[model samples]
Target chain A: MTQPQSRIRRSFGDLSERALAFWLLVPAALLLGLVALYPVGRLLYTSLFRRRLTDETGNSPVFVGFQNFVQAFSDERFWTALWNTLLIVLVTVPGALVVGLLLALLANLPFRVKWPIRLGLLLPWALPLVFAGLIFRWFFDSQYGVINDVIVRLGGERLLWVTTPELLFWAICLSIIWKSSSFVALILLAGLQVIPKELYESAAVDGANRWQSFWRITLPLLIPAILVAAIFRTITAFQTFDIPFAMQNGGSSFETLAMYVRTMSIENLNFGYGSALAVLMFLISFVVTLVYLRYVRGADD
Target chain B: MKKLFWLLVAVLLASTALAQQTRLRVFVGGQQRPDVMRKIFDLYQSRNPGVRVDVEVGGATSDQQQQYLTTVLASRDPSIDVILIDVIRPAQYLASRWADTIDKYLPAASRQELLRRYLPAYSQANVINGQLVALPAFADAMFLYYRADLLEKYGFKPPTTWDEAIQQAQTILQREGNPNLNGIGFIGAPAEGTVCTFLLPIWAAGGDVTNAQGQFSLTVEQAQRALQFWVGLMDQKVSPPNMAEKPQDTIRSEMQAGRWVFGTLFAYAWNRFQNDADSQVKGKIGVVPLPAFAGGRQASCLGGWQWTVSDFSRNKAQAHRLVRFLSSPEVSKILAIEASNLPVFPALYRDADILKVNPWFGQALPVVQAARARPQHPRYAEISEAIRVTTNQVLARQKTPEQGAREIVTRLQAIYGGR
Candidate 1:
C-alpha cells in the first residue's frame, strides 16, 4: 500500500502543467457531471419507456421506445407550449435588452445622486421571481389591481389581463421583462465603465454630435456586452415558469415548455412523458445556448 | 439463581416493550386543519400510550398538500406515515402503490359494520379495486347557492332544473343591470373546479367519465349534451363570460361580495357566506341542490378528504390505529363540531350541534346523498385535466359542444392508449 501511495504521489509530481490543471479539475468536473448529466441521463432513461406512476391497468409502466416523443410531435398542447416559449423569449429578450441599454446609458452619464438611481434600477433583479410574480399579478389583476384601477378611473374598460389569451401572454412577457431587465442593465453598466472617456472626446473633436458618437463609438464597443446579456437573458426566458404559474392556475393559454414539463411530471404524474418533454427542453436550451455562444465567439474572432 | 433469572427475563421483556412502541407522523393540510384533527390524534395517543402521534400541518390548501404529497410519494419516501387524501385522489394513490390497503389493520366484522353505517357515497369513494384503501375524514359536496332576496324579488322559486335556472338568470340580468351583480357566478376555471362543475351535469344525466374496465365509458353525446347546457348559460348571458377563467375562490368572493344573483359553490362556503366579515350577502342567501337537466336527477360533485396509510410506512399499525380512531362516529362528530366539517356518518346529520352550525345541511342532505363522484381511473389527474380543458373551451366558445366532446374523448383515448 505504501509503495502504491508513493507511486501515486510521484505521478502527481511528474504531471505536466496542462495535465495537472486537468487533474486538479477532476473534482469540479465530476461535480459538473453530477449537476448536469445526471438529470439529463435520468430524463433520457425515463423517456425510453411509458413510466406512468399510477399502476392503474392502462397506465402501467411498460417499455415504449420513442413513442412518447412521437406522440409529442402531434400533441397540440406540446406545440402550443413550444410556440409560447419561443414567443416569450422573442418578446422578453429584446424588451429587456432595449430597456437595459437605456438604463445603462442613463446611469453612465455624469449625474447627481448616482447610487440611488443605480439601486432603483437594480431593485427588481434583487427581488425573488415568486415575489416579482406576485407583485406583477397584483399589478394586472382585473378587479382591484392598480393597473385596472387607473384604467377604470381614466374611463377605460378593465382588461381581463390574465384570462384573455393574447393579453395573458403579453402580461407574462411584461413580467419577465420587468424582473430581468435590471440584471441586463447591471451587465451593460459594467461594460459601460470599461469604455474610456477619450473615445467620446475624440469623437466630439471630430465634429460628431452626442447622437452620432453614441451610434458610432458607444454602439460598436457595447455590442459584446449586449450579446453576452442577451445570451443569458434568452436562456433564462426559455425556462419561465413561476410568474405564469402564479398568474393563473391551469389554463393552457400561456403554457411554456417548463410549465408543460411541470404539469406533466408534477401535476399529472406522467413522469415518463414528462421526462421525455424535459429531455427535449434540455436539448433545445442546450442547442440555443450553444448557437448563441458560437455567434458571440464568431463576432469576437 | 431462579430469582436472578426471572429478573433478567423481566428486564429483557421491558426493553422489548419499549422498543415496540411506535411513533408516527401524520401529514395534513393547513395549520387550522391539524388543530381540527388534533382532538382525534390526541384521543388516539391517549388510548395507545405506546404510540406517539405528531400531526404536521403542511400546505395551505388541499391542492398544495396534494402536490407535496405527490413529490414525497413519488420518491417512495416514508416521511409521511398517514397522509390526507383528497376525495378524487384515492384511485390515483392506490394505482401508484403510494398507499396500502388498510383492511388488514381493521377488524373484519367491525369494518363491515362501519361500512354499512356510513353514507354509501362517502364510504364508496374510498374503495378502489374492492380494497379499503382509505376512509372518509369528513363529508362535503357541492351546492347551488342563490341570492334569496334577488330570487324572491324576481318572483322565482328555486330552479329545479338547469333550464329554469338559466331562464330566471337571464330575466334577472336583463332587468337588474345592477352593474354590481351578474346573473350567475360559476367555477369555470381550468383547475379542478371546472372538472367538478362539469361532472355535476354529467353525473346528473347518468353519465360517467370512465368505467371500471379501464375503458373510456363516457360517450361523446354525454359530454356534448352536458357542455351544451352549461355553455348555453354563458352564451345566453346568464353566466359570466369570464367564467372559463375564474376559479372557485374568485366566484366565492364574488358571491360573498353580493356580486351574483345565483352562484354555485362548495358546501364549506356555507359558513363563510353567513358569518364571514367580508360577506356582502350575509343573511341574503339560500342553499339549494344543484339544478339538473329537465327530467334528470339533481347532482353535486362529492368533495372530501380521506385518511390513507403510506405504503412505505414502517409504522402502519400506528397510522391505521390513528385513522380508525379519527373516523370513528364519536370522533367524527367532534371533528364536525371542531372543524365545521360535514360528517361522513349519516347519523351525524341528526346531531343538533351539527345542524345548528350548518342550518343549510337539512336542505342540502338530499343533494349530499345524491352527490356524484368523479371517475375512479388511475390516470384521474389526466382525465380531470381533459374535463377542465374541454369544458373551458366550450365555455369560452372556442369549441362547440360537439367539438369539445370530440376533443375530450380524443385526448382521453390518447392518454389511455396512444402512439
Candidate 2:
C-alpha cells in the first residue's frame, strides 16, 4: 500500500504546476460548458435560422441569418416588452433596496427574540414567485380584491387595479418589491452582522447621533452589500415573468421580454424568433452585469 | 428470523410480478376531473388485469396545459403514454408529430364510423391532413346563461339578437336598482377564452375567419363591427367597466353569485351553477344559444377536449386501446351523467339516462350542433394571440375599433404571409 501510494504521489508530482491547474479546472470547466455555455451556444445557433417545431413538412431549419433579429427590432410587441422589462427593473430594484434596508435595520435591532422578525423577513423570500404573483393578482382584483375592498371601506372610489394597464404596472412593481425585499434584507443583514459593533460604539463615543452614525458608518459599509443585492434584483427584474404573467396571463400591453419569448417559442412554436429574442435579452443582461461589476470594482477602489 | 425470511421472499415474488405488468400514464387537464377519470381507468384495469393505468392531471387552463404539453412533447418525453388536449390542438399536435395517428389502430371502416359518430365540429378538428389524430373525449360550446327567474319576473323572453339583449340588459339594470348587479359579462381579458369571445360576434355576423382554402379570410370591416359591439358594451355599461380583466372563471363565479343578468360561458358552468354549494343561481339559470347580429344566425364557439396517444409512447398499442375505450359511447354516457361533460356522440346527447341527469344538455344539443370551431391552422395559437390581444385593447378602450381591427388584419396577414 505504501509503495503504491508513493508511486501515485510521484506520478502526480511529475505534472507541472500549470498542468496540475489545468487538470484541476477540467471538471469545473466542463460542468460550466454543459450547464451554461451549451444552451447559450444552441440559442445563438437557433437564432440564426427559421425553425418551426410544428411545420408539417419535416423540413430542416432554413438558414435565415439576421432576418429574425431584424424582425424583432421591427416588431412593436417586442419593443413594448423590452420597455416593460426595463421599467420593471428601474422601478422595482430601488424599491426593493430601500424597503429591504429598512426591514434589515429593524430586524437587526437589539430585540429579545430575533427569530420571529427574521422569519417574517424570510417568509416572502421563501414564497414561490408564481404563488406570490397569484396572491398579488387576487389582492389587486377589481371587484372583490382586498385593495378595492379597503378603498371602498375608507370612502374612496374603487379603482380598477388590474384592468387598467398603468395601475397594473404599479401593482406588479409593488408585489415584486414585497417579494424580493426580504432576500435583499437577508443579504444586508449578513453585512450588518459583520459590521463590527465596536465602530458604532466608537462613533457614539465621538458624540455621533444614531442617524449620523448610520449615515456615516453603516451606509458607507453597507454599500457593497447593497450593490450586490441590486445586481441580483436587476438581473431577475429583467427576466420578470411569473408575477406579470400570473396577473395578466400575457396580456400584450404588460408583457415582459421573457413572456414574449414564451409566446413565440412555446405558443407559436417559432423557436427561431424566440431564440433571437432570448439572445437579445441575454445581451442586455450581460451588458447590465458588466456595468454593475464595474461599479462594484469602483466602489472597492 | 425464519418468519422474516419467508416474508422477504414473498415480497420479492410480488415485486417481480408487479414489474411484469404494464403501467401506462394518462395525462389529463384539470378541467377533466381526475377522480372521475381514475374511476374510468379502474374499470379498464379490471378488464385488463395485466395493465395499470395511472392518471396525471395537468394545468387548469387551456393555455397552461398547452404550454406544459408543448415542453413535454417537444422533448419527446415517453413517460406519458396518452394525453388529453384541447379541441384546437389536434392540428398542431399532428403537424409536430407529437400525436400518433389513429389510422393504423383502426380499420378504414371503423375510422369512418368513429368519425361519423362524433359531432361534426369535433370530427373536423380531429381529422387533419386526412389523418385521424385524436378522439373526442367530450363536447362543449359557449352558451348564453341568464337568470330565468329574473326574466320571468320581468315578463320578458330571452333575447335572440345582440341589440335586443343590450336593450333588455339596460332595462333590467335600471329596474333592478342594484348597484352590485351588472347587465352582461363575457371574457374580455387577453386569455384563451378571449379568442372565442372575439370570434363569437364575427361568426354570428356571418363572417368567416378562414375561407374554404384555409386562408385567413376575416375582413377588416367584420373585425371592426365585432370590436364596436364589444366596445359599446363596456362604454354603455352593459358589461362591467373592468370587463377586460374578467376571465371565464371570474365571469362564471360572478354570474353564479347572481351579479350578472347575462353571461357568456361554456357548458360546464351549468353543472356548477346548479350544484355548487355557494351557487346562488341554482334552479334559476337558463341556458340559450348565444345572441346573433340582427341580420345573421346564432353561432357558438365549439370547445371541448380530445384524447390522443403520444407518438413517443412506448406502449403505443395499449395507449391506443385505452383511448378508444375511454372515448367509447358507453363511457361518454357515463361521463355525461356523472361529470356533466357533454357527450361527443349525438346518440348519447339524446340518451334517456343522460337527459335524466342533465336536462339542459337537451337544450345544448342544438347549440352544440351549430357551434363553430376557431380557425384551424397549425399556428392557430399565434392567430389566437393576435386576435385576442387586439380585441383586449379595444375592450380596454386603449384602441378604437378601427385600430384594433386594422391591427388584427395586419398581424394575421403577416402570419398567413409568413407561411
Candidate 3:
C-alpha cells in the first residue's frame, strides 16, 4: 500500500505543465471527438455502404465500397453542381468584396447619414435568409416586381428575372451579394476604424493624394481583414443553398453542391450516395481553404 | 402572504406537470388551412377537456413538412403522436413499417364508419399490403378552370383533348387581340405542381409512371409525347412564355388578371376563382375535367393529406381518438366547407351545407371520381423527382419530347432497376 501511494505521488510530481494541460484538455478533446470526429467518421463509414432510409431489407447496411463515389463521378448532376458551385464562388466573392470595400470606405467617411446607412447595411444580414430571399424574389418578380416595374418605366423589356435559368442564376447572385456584402462590409469597417489617423495625416503632410493614400496605406493595412472577409465569403459562396433554393427553387441548371447533397440525401433518401457527395464537398472545401491559406502565407512571405 | 403565494405557485406547477404527461404532440403543416385546423382542434379540445393536443405547426411547404416527418420516422421517434401525412408519404411510412395501423388502434365503430363512408380511392390508397396504414383525412384533385365568357365568346365548348385544347387556345389568343392575354396557364414550374399538371394528360391517356403489372410501363416515349404536347403550347405562343416557371398561385393570379382563356388549378382554386373580390374572372369562369390525349381516358391526379398515428407513440389511444374525431361526418363537413377541402367522405358530397358553400363542387364530382393517384412506390419521392425533372426539361425546351421521355425512363430504371 505504501509502495502504491509513493508511485502515485511520483506520477503527480512527473506531471509537466504541458502534461497537466493535456490531462485537463482530455474532456474537451473527447467531447470534440464525440461531436465532430464521430459524425464525420460515421459519415465516411456510411458512405461506403448502400443504406437506404426506406431499406425494405431491414436497416442493416449492405457494403458497397467506392461504388457511391464512382456513381457520383459518373453522374451528370455532380459535374453540373461542382461547376455551378465554382461559378458562384468565383462570381460572388469578388462582387461582394468590391461592394463591401466600397461600402466600408463610404461608412468610414464623416457623413451625416452614417447611422442610417449603417442601419440599412445591417438590415440584410439581420433579416433571416428566408425573409431576405422572399424580399429579393418579390423585387425580382417577372410581373409587378419593383425591379421589373422600374425597367418597364424606363421603356425596357420586362425580363423573366426568376423564370429563365440564366436570369435566375444572376438573380441568385444578386440576392447573395445583397445578403452577404453587408456582413463583409461590417467586417471591413471594423478594420478600417482601427487604421491610425496619424498615418493618413503624415501621408497628407507628404502631399500624397486621397486615392494614393487609400491604395498605399489603407489597403495594405486592410489585407488581414480582406483575407478574413474573403475566406468567410468564399466558404459561404461554396456552400450556396438558401438564396438559390428560395429564389430559383433549385432550377436544373443551378443545382449547387449543397443542394446536390440535399437532393441525394433528403429528397432521394439515398443516404449512402448523399454522404459520399457531402464528404466530397467537405474535401473540396478543405483543399481550397488549404491552397488559399498557402497562397496567403506565400504572399505574406 | 409570501408563503400563501408560494403554495399557490406549487399547486399550479404540480398541475402543469401532470397536464404535460397527457399532452399529445401532433405534426401539422402550418401553411395548409391553419385557421380551419385551429377551429377543428379547438372543437376537439372543447369536447375532450382531459386530454391536450399540442399542435407543432411546421414547414412553409408540404415538401418541407414531409422532410420533417421523414426525419422523425427515420429514428422511430415516439414524440409525435399523430402526423399529418401528405398523400404520397404513406408508401414511405409503410415501407419502414413505422406508423401504426388505423385498423389496429381505431375503435371498431369508428373504423367501420370510416370504411363505409370514405371515398373508394382514398380508402384504397391509404392501405398498404392489405394493412390499413392510415385514415383518409381530406381530398384534393386537379380542376381545369376555364374562362366561360371567353369560351362562349369564341363559340367553343371546353376542349376535351390536348389537341383540341391547343387549337382552342390559339384561336382565343388571336381573337382576344390583347397582347397581354395568353391562351392558357398552368403550374409549369418544376415543382410538385408541375409534376401534377404534366402527368394529368399522360395519365388520362392511360399512361403511368408504372402500371399495375409491376413493370415500368411508362415509356420515355409516352412521357416525351406529354412533354412535347405541353411544350407545344409555349411554342405556339398560346400559353404565355412566363407560364413555364409559374406556380399554381401565379397561374391563378394571371387568370384573375384575365390574361388566360384556360387554366389548370387545384380544387382550392374553385372558390377563389369564382368568388375572390380581386378575381377578374369571377362569375365568368367554368370548371372542367383535365382533357386527355385524344381517345384516352379522363384523369385528374389524386392529391391530399392523410392522418396516421406514429407507431412509436406513447399516446396512440389519444391519437386514434383525434383521428376518429377528425374523420367524423360533422367535422369532415366543416373541413370540406370552411377549409375548401374536397371531402374524402362519399356521403358529404350531397350535404346541403357543403353544396351551399361550394357550388362548383357539383362540377368537381365527376373529376374527383376519376382521380388517378400517383404510383404508391416506396421510392415515390424519387419517382416524383424524375417526373418533375423530365417535365421541366421538356417545358424549358432543353430536350425533345422523345429525349425527355427517354430520360424519364433512364431515371426511373436507375432508381427501380427496371424490372
Q: Write down the lDDT of every candidate, Cα atoms only.
A: 0.82, 0.90, 0.81
Please identify which of the two predictions, 1 or 3, would achieve the higher DockQ against the true structure: 1
Interface RMSD, candidates in the order listed: 3.2, 2.0, 2.5
Tens-digit per-residue lDDT, B1-419, candidate 2: 99999999999999998998889999988988888898999999999988999988998898888889888988889999999999988988888899899999889997888789888888899999999999999999999999889888888899898888898899899999999899989998889899898888889878888788887799999999988888889888888778888889989998988999999999899999989999998899998989888888899999999999999999999999999998899889888988899999988877888899898788888899999998877888988899888888788777889999999988899877865
Docking class of 1: acceptable
lDDT score for residue B141 of model 2: 95
Which ranges in model 1 have alpha carbons more than 4 Å from their true place?
A: A1-26, A56-61, A292-301, B1-21, B107-109, B152-156, B167-177, B211-215, B416-419
Q: Which candidate is the best by TM-score?
A: 2
Ranking by lDDT: 2, 1, 3
TM-score of 1: 0.89
Write down the RMSD of candidate 3 (Cα, Å). Answer: 5.2
Best by lDDT: 2
Worst 10 residues of 3 chain A by lDDT: A245-254
Give me the runs in candidate 2 sitting further than 4 Å from their true place. A1-24, A56-59, A292-301, B1-20
Clashing pairs in 3: B220-B405
Chain A accuracy as TM-score for every candidate: 0.90, 0.93, 0.88
